[model samples]
Target: MCQEQKGFTLWFTGLPCSGKSAVADRVAEILRSRNLKVERLDGDIVRKSLCRDLGFSREHRNENIRRVTFVAKLLTRNGVAVLTSFISPYREIRDEARREIGEFIEVYVKCPLEVCMARDVKGMYQKAIKGEIKEFTGISDPYEEPLQPELVLETDKETLEESAQKVINCLKKLGYLDHNF
Candidate 1:
């Protein structure tokens, strides 16, 4: 197999409004600008396709993570950087993806629930409050944070540009990046 065949998957895990997807979007854009092949596999888009009718129960959440992990594995094996923004919410689920994907990099979009709710660009928190959505994350459900992520980002304290730069630096440090690659 070609050495370059081992591409990477940067999995962004956080609460619903915790800027996980936002940071992933910026990171993907920057990587593409550098001529690096990258694809973003976001939860909302994936769920709407493969898991549309799935509820917010823990089982459903785990299944969602599994589906994303499968896709990420395929993309990474095909030499494309895969950025997954999903509220994986469970350490076991995230760990399963790590073990399965092998080249996975976990980046925790760490932000307090209050901070995430305040940044609720989609008003999910407000709707959850009115019982419009049941078992919403960081509210009715629990989010098991990563114990030792390869990269941990405090999204609440940094701009999206800064956050993307942080991940880029991490990849460089890991020798997964080179100016001529």
Candidate 2:
């Protein structure tokens, strides 16, 4: 039987279309390939299920983060790596998540707003600009960038593989994974 391994939460935060979800998905794939139990809490998908009643208000956003953090903490303690992809616009909520989830790695996926707008497949950014979406982060609302994230991935400059490899390297460096990676 394989020895049990410690689990950690890899939190990805950024603006809409900033590559947080894409990078998190790639990271999950790599970790799963290495035989790690992984759970991905994507904001869009989770909001539909876990937070169906939640809205875009600050309180709701924090509540969403809290819910995700709670699950992440549970999974981490049970040896399941959790990758959370949320805009998580507020620094306080992100810090709260870090405190609640002991083993947390905050990855700031950096991309210019213009680049993000251009990459917006959902047209949410355009709608936000037109006042169709209220409390929309980065356009109608605010996105407080992480002050001291564990890792910063300039998704605009790096390929998906490079960003994912960086996260994998960080996990190995922090002893979350075997050094052979």
Candidate 3:
């Protein structure tokens, strides 16, 4: 039998501009400061590299989720805290991730659509509104959120630090962190 590594995945799922990436970045940094190996894989970054050819089509989105989930499993098996930020948009994909990786925590970064559009840090919402972008979740497409996630973070009102601290606390409580130093 293969030995299990002391690694886990904290998956962040939310609409664009919902603060998933920013909060994941903070949580990963906090975990690393305590000596835990960390790997953050954001959807935008992945699309720019491994999934550069992918489009906004639903089929492509599903494939993107699968690819990211596969990489998350690999990283977790190798003893890295894999933090994945993506607007996964499907319960089926999240379920697959749970089955593939033994330790997967799905965090729903809940933000109102209006709030997300206002933030639009990447200007994706603007492009979608201008009809320049297609199959945009919450605009031209849909984002079916997780039915029951481990944590539902309301980022519209919460500070990124607060959101990150909640995730860190959960990890510490779950023994994913040896101790929150």
lDDT, residue 61, model 3 = 85
Q: What TM-score does each of the candidates earn?
A: 0.94, 0.98, 0.93
Question: Model 1 segments beyond 4 Å from truth?
Answer: 1-5, 179-181
After superposition, the stretches of candidate 3 with alpha carbons farther than 4 Å from their true spots are 1-5
Residue by residue across 77-180, what tens digits does model 1's lDDT show? 89998999998999998999999999989999998889988988889999998889899888888889899999988878888888888888888877777744
State how far residue 111 of model 3 sits from its true place (Å): 0.4
- Please report how far candidate 2 places residue 15 from its true position, in Å: 0.4
lDDT of 3 by residue, 55-105 (tens): 877788888988988899999988999999999887887888899988999
Clash pairs of candidate 1?
Answer: none
- C-alpha lDDT (0 to 100) for residue 134 of candidate 2: 90
RMSD of 1: 2.0
lDDT of 2 by residue, 1-181 (tens): 9789898999999999999999999999988897789999999899999999999899999999999999999999999999999999999999999998999999999999999999996899989998988998888889999999999999899999999999999988888888996
Error of 1 at 121 (Å): 1.1
Which regions of candidate 2 fall more than 4 Å away from where they truly are?
none
* Deviation from native of the Cα of residue 128 in model 3, angstroms: 0.8
Candidate whose lDDT is highest: 2
